[model samples]
Target chain A: MWAITRLLAGKDLRVEMRSRVIINQVVPFAALMMVMFAFALDSDTVLARVAPGLVWLAAMFSLLVIVQRSFALEAADGALDALRVAGANAGGIFLGKALALAAQLAVLEVILLGAALVLYNSHIVGSGIALLVGTYFTATAGLAFVGTLYGGLAVGAKGRETLLPLLMLPVVAPVLIGATRATEAALGTNGATATDGWPWVGLLTLFAVVFGVGGTLSFGSLIDE
Target chain B: MNPLINMDTRATSTRFTSALGLATLIGLGWLAVFGLFLSPNDRVQKTGVRILYIHVPSAWLAYLAFVVTGLASAGYLWKRTRSLTLDRIAGASAEVGVLFMGITLVSGSLWGKISWGTYWTWDSRLTTTAFLFVTYIGYLAVRDLGGSHEQRARRSGVLALLALVEVPLVHFSVRWWRPLHQQESVAKGKLSDLMLFTLFVGLVSFTLLYVWLVMHRQRVAALDDMVDDGGLDRALADRRSEGMP
Candidate 1:
């Protein structure tokens, strides 16, 4: 199971690396969103105040793109059917795809964080670094697991492009809420202490674990037909 | 023709369904009288509190409907209990649930404007309920994504299960995010007995209405599946006949 997971994850990563879609298209898109937010809000104070939310919102929108790309890759070439015929463990396939998505999202988030700091002039408290990192890790994992799960559901369906976000965004509300609040606390904005961030991180972790285990168990049945 | 397939063309009525519909109609009539004219208004909210009769029941029935959807979806997913009937029930309940949830949101917003001086709030319950509504709408969209009945059931069943699990997490996360500055109570204080009775009537009527709607909607969905299957069967038969000649 672990071997299949690694092999699949590596294959997805290699495809992503060679294609450079994330670097060329998605990163610039995320940055453009941050800049757009700055223009829309039109205030340094307001932008800094809401920077945490804006950052997560941008990450989430980028998540939609990356997830769509991930599943589209499999479906375009009937790779999913091939994997099933190859008799690879379904759970491993789910985890592998989620793992690759998480890795891509992690890099995107780092750039998003940097973009937020530079564009919005947002400042992170020194002592809250650990909390900030924790928020990114747990929230990214939750988003990746859920995105993969729903992506699989929508993969072969009609109008999947529109359907995936509709299906995924509402379900990811917890991650958005938890991540935004946690990021706000970590950045010491909205008068939230670093201590306030931990609970939100816990919520993100819970979301990740529930979807991770559930998605693994059910992915086979979902993609079977 | 398959007897089961042939049966789909018949009207989806029975003695029990007729009885249920009649009870729902009578209950709704009684509820309207009690809720609108008979119940006393609160000292604080006055007439604004009247909307709660519709709003509360709609919200309650919506939750109940989604729960039914989840259970039916689960039944379809489980191999031992799998059936298209369960899938139809799931889809029907979700559609009704969305209707009621829309009523809940619109009425709640109107009520909020009357009382809170705003049509919207970042309140946890409101936000979480909105999330729930959207999730199920997506479920319904997946149902319409063009597939065989079993394909629809399998995909949507997984989605229903996942969405159900996310509800609590969405609720608590939103709750903790804001920490609810207002008391968030249904009423300012304890309700008068008459008011309570009216609310009870509302709940009962709305629940009966939900059952009636689901029963009819499930039948409609079954007929829909039959038509789809019938079309495919006919097409196959035509192709086979051409080859035979």
Candidate 2:
């Protein structure tokens, strides 16, 4: 299982490294989201106050793109069939794809954090940065697990590009709420507590476990022709 | 006449449905009369509280519909008794669920405007209901993706179950996030007897209305399946005559 997961993750990482689509396309899109938010709000104080949420919104939008690409990559040349015929375990395949997506999102989110700090004239200093990282990991895990599952389900379905986000965004509301509130607490805004972030962390973790395991066990059924 | 197309059964069922629809109409009419005229207004809420009769029952029916959808989906997924009927029931219930969810949101918005002084709020119940609305709308959309009956049934049954899991999670998450909505006490000691009676009338009538809608929709689905199967059979026969294996 470990070997298959690594092999699949390595395959995706190699494709991402060569293409740099995440760098050239998605990162800039996330950055543009910050710039647009700043322009729309048109107040430095308000922008600063809302930067945490803006960062999360950017991550989620980028997530839609990444998950779409993940499934699309397989569906293109029947690579999904190729993987199945290669005797890859469904659970390993799910975990590998989720890990690969999470890795890409982690990089995108780190860049967005910098963009949020610089573009919104906000700063994160202290042990609070650790909380921010924690929130990012858990939130991304939940999103990747869920997004990958739904992406696979939506693949080959009609109008999947439009369908995936409609299916995904509402389901991930708790993550958005948790991640935003956690980020706000980390930034010492909204009179929020570091303790306030824990339940959100727990929720994100639960989402990750439920969807992650559920997606793994169900992937075989989803991929059945 | 074909047994499946028996005029007597069809006519009787249609008549029964109309009779049930009329009763529902009368039940709802009396509910409005009771809610609007007979039930006394709250000292604090006054007439604005009238929205509660519609809003609460709609939310209740939405939850009830989704729960039925979940159970029907479970039946569809289980191999022992797997049937198209289960799938059809699930889809029908989800459709009714989405309709009621929409009503819940719209009425809640109006209620909030009258009482909370805003058209919307991030209040926990409101937020969760909105999520429920969108999720089932997605469910209904996925049903239209047009696969083989088995594939569509399997995929949608899985999605229905997954979405069901979110109902409780959304409820808890929102409750923890913001305790803004009023606590659930309508069935408790909160309301006066007349108000409680009116509310019960609303609940019972709306539930019957949901059953009527689901049954009618399920029959429509069955007819649709018959038509779809006939089309496929004709297509296959045409292909066979053309020597296309």
Candidate 3:
């Protein structure tokens, strides 16, 4: 387990250092999303009300794209094939990867928050930002946790470009609900807070644990592939 | 060559009856022609409610498909028996789930226009059903993972179990997330005899569609597998016997 963790962290760190792919992609994607959103709305009042959810949503999307790239790097290098052949534990591998993915997403979210602060004219690290951070971490944990599972499933396929969204969007709806609502609540809607979203948080957390555990359990089966 | 099909019993096409397929066609035709176009325009919801027949049944099929997929997926993993029947069940269920979900989305939106004075709303039922679309979409995604048969099956089995989370989440997210969609009154419990009877029949018809499609697709797959296996073995033989001889 420790070995897998080291490999996971090492592999992602190496990639991040060499290509800086996630930063190049996530930062730009998130920034563009914010700009487009601001362009569409162009209202300061509306921006304040919608900013938290927008930040979280854009961050979530940026992170999803990041997760795929993370896995795709391993896939292209045949690292996954080598890992399975070496008799590495599937659970450990998934854990290591999920951790790294979460870590990378956190970094991206911070950048996104910074950009939004300057661009959207909102407080950067305020309570709303706190809610955004919490929601991003929780929802992203669920996303990466599930992402690794699907990554293995979609590791090989034609038109995989098409498959990822079809496969991903629906499964992660709960995260969107919880994160968006929690963000909405944090921004001071009378009834839209995580107080209600706490259950959704609970749901997102539950989904993460269940699928993460299940994905790890079944990871061995994909070892040969 | 694994000795499973060497029992000398030739596979037959009896199960592939024209009659059963025709009967389903007739039933669907009756529903579309009579039940849909011929049914009353509804008392409360008016023409808008007519889409309910499509929406409700589509939602029903989506849910049923999830349950069936889960069951068959469980069986495949538990026994590791490699049954074609179970594989077909999973395959059919996912496809039907997606198709019904598509219907549910479209008809729901169309219904929403007349009922809610808009084409879209974030109501709870709509949200869950939309998520329902995602759950099975993931299943369909899992099915496409390329690998050897056993490996694919094992991976998909785990996915099947994981995707079941959407079932409760979809069903409850309505009440869970206070949206425009009404809380369940009849579908969950409060069904009048008229509604229940129509729904029961609708459910039966949907199930029938599922069964027929699954069996047909299974037959096609089994045949394709047989042809490939036979061709490979014949190519390898030191001497050609069966078809060559």
Candidate 4:
């Protein structure tokens, strides 16, 4: 299972590397969203105060694009059906796709943090830096698991472009709430101590575990033809 | 008459369903009188407290409805219990649940206006309820996505299960994000006896109404599936006849 997972994850990453869709399209889109937030908020104080939330919001929207692209790759050329016929383990497929999504999102988030720091002029306190990284890791994992699962669910359907977001966004509300709060605590912008961020990270970790196990167990039944 | 096709065009009603509807109507009327005219005003909230009769019960029933939906979806997914009926039940319950959830939110908003001096607040309970409402709405959308019945069942069953698991996570995250709301008055036995009784009446009536609606909705869903299947069969038959001629 681990071998299959590695192989599929490597395939997705290599495909992504060759295509450069995440680097070329999704990254700019996420950065543009951060810039747009700066424009909409306009005030430096307000922008700095809410930078954590803006960053996660940008990440969440980018998640939709990345998940759609991941599943769309499989759907475009009957790759999913071929995998099924080849008797590939469904759990491995789910984990591999989710792993690839998390990797891409990790990179996107690093860039988003830079954008927040530069554009929003947000400063992360020394103690909170570790909390901020923890939030990114756990929250990204949670979002990837959910995004991949719902992407597969909506992939073959008509109007899937609209359907995927509708199906996915509500479920990921926890990640948005948790990640934003943890990030805020890390930035020390809202009178929250760095210790306050750990509990939210715990929530994110719980979410990741629940969906990660749940997604692996159920992905076969969901995407089965 | 083909056994494969049901020709009945009448509404899916039965004697038991009629009895259930009648009981719901009577219960609703009783609740309205008691909740509005009979129950005493709270010293603090006064007339605004009356909305609790509708708001609290609607919220409870909405949760109940979603629970029913989750169970029905589980039944459909389990091979030993798999059936289109369970899928229909899940779909029906979710539809009714959304309606009740909408009522809960609107009423809660009104209550908030009276109590919190705003039409909306980012309170934990309010946020979680809103998220649950949207989640179920998305679940219903997935059900409407075109697919074979089995495909619909499998996809939505997995979704329902996943969404159900996320509810607690969403609740806790929101609660921690901002915890502000009066502690639940009912659980604390803070209400007067008459108010409590009226609230009880509200709960019973709303539950009955949920049952009546879900029963009718499930039957309608079964009929809808039959019509869809029958239409495809008729189309195939027509094509075959055209080729023969």
Candidate 5:
């Protein structure tokens, strides 16, 4: 188990550094999202109203693209078949895939944070920065737990790109609402408090536990089909 | 690619059809007819409340279909039997789920226009049903994502498991938060003996239709598999000799 974990994690990180595939896909999308949101706002004042939602919504959309690439890379050239033959448990595979997703999403959020700060003149580097960054990870951890599973499912289908958002959007509603509300509160005119960040954390923790464990146990069987 | 081929001669599926499919078809017809005729109109809303006949049943069956999809998904992941029957069952349920959910939404909106003076309420039941409908559409969409049969089955099982989380959330969202939809405590509130009988008949009949359609769909899927296996040309040739279309 330990060997498999290391192998899976090492592989993703190695390829990520070599190809920089995640950053290549993610940075441009986050930049474009901020530019689009900037155009949508009629005035600087209205930016505050929609800022939190746009930040996370954009982050979520970018994360979807990263998740797709993460699996797509594995599926090419028998890389996934190699992982399976390496004696990796389904649990290890799930854990590694989710970790790769988490890594990719964390980077995406960083780019988004930079854009939000510049575009909206939102304050950073204090409680708000901590809250926004923390909740972003929690909520997205929950999102990636399931996203990798479905990303795998979509491996060979026609129209996979079109099909993914249709499947993912409704299921991601909780993350959408929770992340939006949490980030909004953190960056709000209101001062930061644990109250703003903790509940979102708690709910997301529950989500991660249920789906994370379920995916671990079931991951092996899914690929066999 | 011949779209329609006769499946009656297929020998592998005969045993499975007898258990649940036939009994339900008879029940659906009886209930739908009786409920349409016998139930009295609501006192406050008058005849507009009659739309509940479609709304409630469609809502019920929609949920039932998703539940079946989840179970089939679980079964596929666990047993790895590659049971085409299970995938076919999951597909039918998702299709029916979307269909019924649509009826519930449309009929509910019509009821709302008269009852609430607005065409839409975002009411609790209506909101949940709409969200649930979207979820199933996602289910169907995800099942088509990967190119190969193996890819479709694996990915769909994963998506099904993930989406099932929303089922509980949608059902309980009303209690968890305030919403525009209403609370449904009973099947239209302590239905009288006749109403109860009608409701039973309705549930049974709808369930029957669900089964019959599923059977026919499976047969079609099986024939498609055969054609993909190089049987289509042969079957079409056989049919041409008999001068069938």
Candidate 6:
């Protein structure tokens, strides 16, 4: 199972390396979003205060595109069918695609963090950095699981391009809420306000576990012809 | 009795639904007369508290609708009991659930404005309810994305079950985050006898209304299936005439 997962993940990454889509297209899009958000708020101080939220919004929006792109790669020339014929386990495929998507999101988050620091003059060097990274991965795991599952479910759906986002954005609300709050805590802008950020991390972890396990178990059913 | 011998399932179900609808209408009228005109104002909220009659019941019904959707979804996905009937029931309940969720949010917003001095609050209940509304609206939207009946049912059933996982999380998120919305009222025994009675009447009536609506909606879905099949037949006939395989 692990071998299949690694192989599939490697396949996705190799394809990505050759195409350079995430580097060339998605990263630039994330940078553009950072500048757009700064302009939309039109105040450096206010933007700095809200930088955590802007960063999360940028990651999630980018995630929607990455998820779609991952599935779109499979749709070309029936690569998904080839994977099935090659005897890849459904669970492994789910995990591989999700892992690949999560890896891409991690890179995107790093780039977006730089953009936030550069554009909004946001600070990240603090004890809350641990909390921030943990929350980002947990939240990304949750997003990647659903995004991939829904990507497959909606791939053949009518108005699929529009359907995927509408399906995903709502389910990820808690993740956004958790990631944003946890980011705020890490940045010390809120100063342990309302509740400490750990609970939000706990929520994100719960989302990650639930969707990760649920998607793995159900992927076979989702792809059944 | 042979199961298929005399079963006019739609006719029988339609008759039963009409009776339930009539009972619900009468019950709602009773609730309105007592809740709107008879129940005295709260010391704190006064007349504004009356929105609870509608708001609370809608909230309860929305959850009930989703639970039904979830159960039917589970039935559809499980190998032993999978059937189009379960899928139709799941779809109907989700649509009705979305409708009640909208009512819950709108009525709750009105209630909040009078009491909390704003049309919205990030209170756990209101926020979660809004999230619930959006999630199920997306559920209904996914249902509309065209597919073969079995394909649509499988995808939708899985999605429904997944969405159900969020209900408890949403319910407790406020408690986990900050207590903005009021906690469960009936369970806490916070209401007086008359107020509780009014709430009970509203709950019972709304539940009946939910049953009636779901049954009618299920019938509509069955009709939709017929039309879809007809469309497929016409398409196939056209293909045959075009000398295509």
Candidate number achieving the greatest DockQ relative to the actual structure = 1
TM-score of chain A of each: 0.98, 0.96, 0.85, 0.98, 0.89, 0.95
Local error of candidate 6 at residue A124 (angstroms): 2.8
- Identify the CAPRI category of the predicted complex in candidate 5: acceptable
Rate residue A115 of model 6 by lDDT: 89
True contacts kept of each: 0.92, 0.56, 0.59, 0.87, 0.51, 0.51
Local accuracy by lDDT, each model: 0.91, 0.85, 0.69, 0.90, 0.70, 0.84
DockQ score, prediction 4: 0.84
Mark the regions of model 3 whose C-alpha exceeds 4 Å error after superposition.
A124-136, A187-200, B1-19, B22-41, B46-55, B114-116, B170-175, B183-199, B227-245
Candidates sorted by TM-score, best first: 4, 1, 2, 6, 3, 5
lDDT of 5 by residue, A139-174 (tens): 778778878766765654567677777766666666
Backbone Cα, N, C clashes tallied per candidate: 0, 0, 2, 0, 13, 0
Q: What lDDT does model 6 reach? A: 0.84
lDDT, candidate 3, B54-153, per-residue tens? 6777788787877888888888888756675676578777787788889889888887778778888776666667776776776776666655556656
Model 3 residue B223 lDDT?
Answer: 64
- lDDT winner among the candidates? 1
**TM-score of predicted structure 2:** 0.91
Residue B236 displacement in candidate 1 (angstroms): 7.2
Q: Alpha-carbon error at B29 in model 1, in Å?
A: 1.1
The per-residue C-alpha lDDT of model 4 at residue B221 equals 89
Question: Candidate 5: misplaced stretches above 4 Å?
Answer: A123-130, A189-197, B1-38, B80-83, B119-125, B142-155, B169-181, B185-200, B230-245
Give each prediction's DockQ, rounded to 2 decimals. 0.87, 0.67, 0.50, 0.84, 0.40, 0.60
Grade the docking of candidate 6. medium
What are the per-residue Cα lDDT tens digits for candidate 4 across A150-212? 998887778889988888888898899889989999999868889989989998999999999
Model 5 per-residue lDDT tens digits across residues B203-241: 666766666666666666666556655566766677687
Instruction: Give the TM-score of candidate 1 (chain A).
Output: 0.98
For all predictions in the order shown, the interface RMSD in Å is 0.9, 1.1, 2.7, 1.0, 3.1, 1.8
After superposition, which runs of candidate 4 have C-alpha atoms over 4 Å from their true positions?
Answer: B3-6, B236-245
Question: Across residues A55-170, which tens digit of lDDT does each residue of candidate 2 receive?
Answer: 88989999999988888888898888788898888788888888999999999999998998888877774757778878888999998898888888888776999999999998
